[model samples]
Target: MSEKTGQCLCGAVKLTARNVPSTFNICYCDMCKRWAGGRFMGLHVAKDDLNVTGGDSVTEAVTSDWAKRAFCNTCGSSLWYEVTDGPYVGGRSICVGLLDDTSDLTLGTEYYTDRKTRAYDFPEGRKQLTEAEVLALFAPTDAEEGEPE
Candidate 1:
């Protein structure tokens, strides 16, 4: 139940999250890569425990039917990725790159290994899951029914 505070680039938006775990996750999906300019590193922050000041400066986009991403409108700094609907509704993963301090964060997991390109590679021995495996872990139960599961 650690507490951390961070702000977007240019300090236009300030955020605090309570009950944060010490681990961070990385996403290597194409959308994430395009969003963050490479793999996206995120710190899981519960929606209920997150507080933001200067919300007026934050703009969000619905990246997918199930998720949306928010960023600082002023500096265009990536803020967070949030579940928009389904079982993960209200959950958020904040951008770790904007953290004011991150001496405590450890690599927890990486998803979209299959999407990883030969142009870049992370260190060996990281716990990783391919795109299909990620879908199995996160796809909402409703989406699984009657779909190509």
Candidate 2:
């Protein structure tokens, strides 16, 4: 496994992934879109395989049912996608941009395709979905403002 490391734009926070990911996903989830202003690539990183070095300045945001968004407080650099749901099922969706080199690996999988806006078309040639599809798969536990759960 090749070593991968990255830091915020201001160098205030940094992280390292000890091993390369076997699965990569480009998510078009609404929350992701709101967070990144568009699609955010999520590389399935093993929880135990990730380590943060200069992490004191890294900020975390709890977004949903079992998800959290991490970023640099000073630079606002999107860091990693963390899901803390206990040992066996826990994982992190690391940002590919954080890697030292991403020229070798290919895009493995794309998710949250259903949440993409109708105006933007994806180029990955992967399966596509719409808002309804996303709601069907993973809907909010409680009723939304205009929608029923």
Using all chains and alpha carbons, the TM-scores for the candidates as numbered come to 0.79, 0.71
Candidate 1: tens digits of C-alpha lDDT, residues 20-41: 9999999999889988888999
Q: Model 1: which ten-residue window has the lowest total lDDT?
A: 140-149
Give me the candidate number with maximum lDDT.
Answer: 1
What TM-score does candidate 1 get on C-alpha atoms? 0.79
| Runs in model 1 lying further than 4 Å from the true structure | 122-149
lDDT for predicted candidate 1 compared with the true structure: 0.90
| lDDT against the true structure, each candidate | 0.90, 0.76
Per residue, candidate 2 scores C-alpha lDDT tens digits across 1-149 of 56677666787877787777555678888888778657888777677888887677888999987789998888788887887565526678877776666776677877777776665675678788899998888865555645654
Candidate 2 ranges with C-alpha deviation above 4 Å: 86-88, 118-149
lDDT of model 2 at residue 52?
Answer: 81
Quick one: best TM-score, which candidate? 1
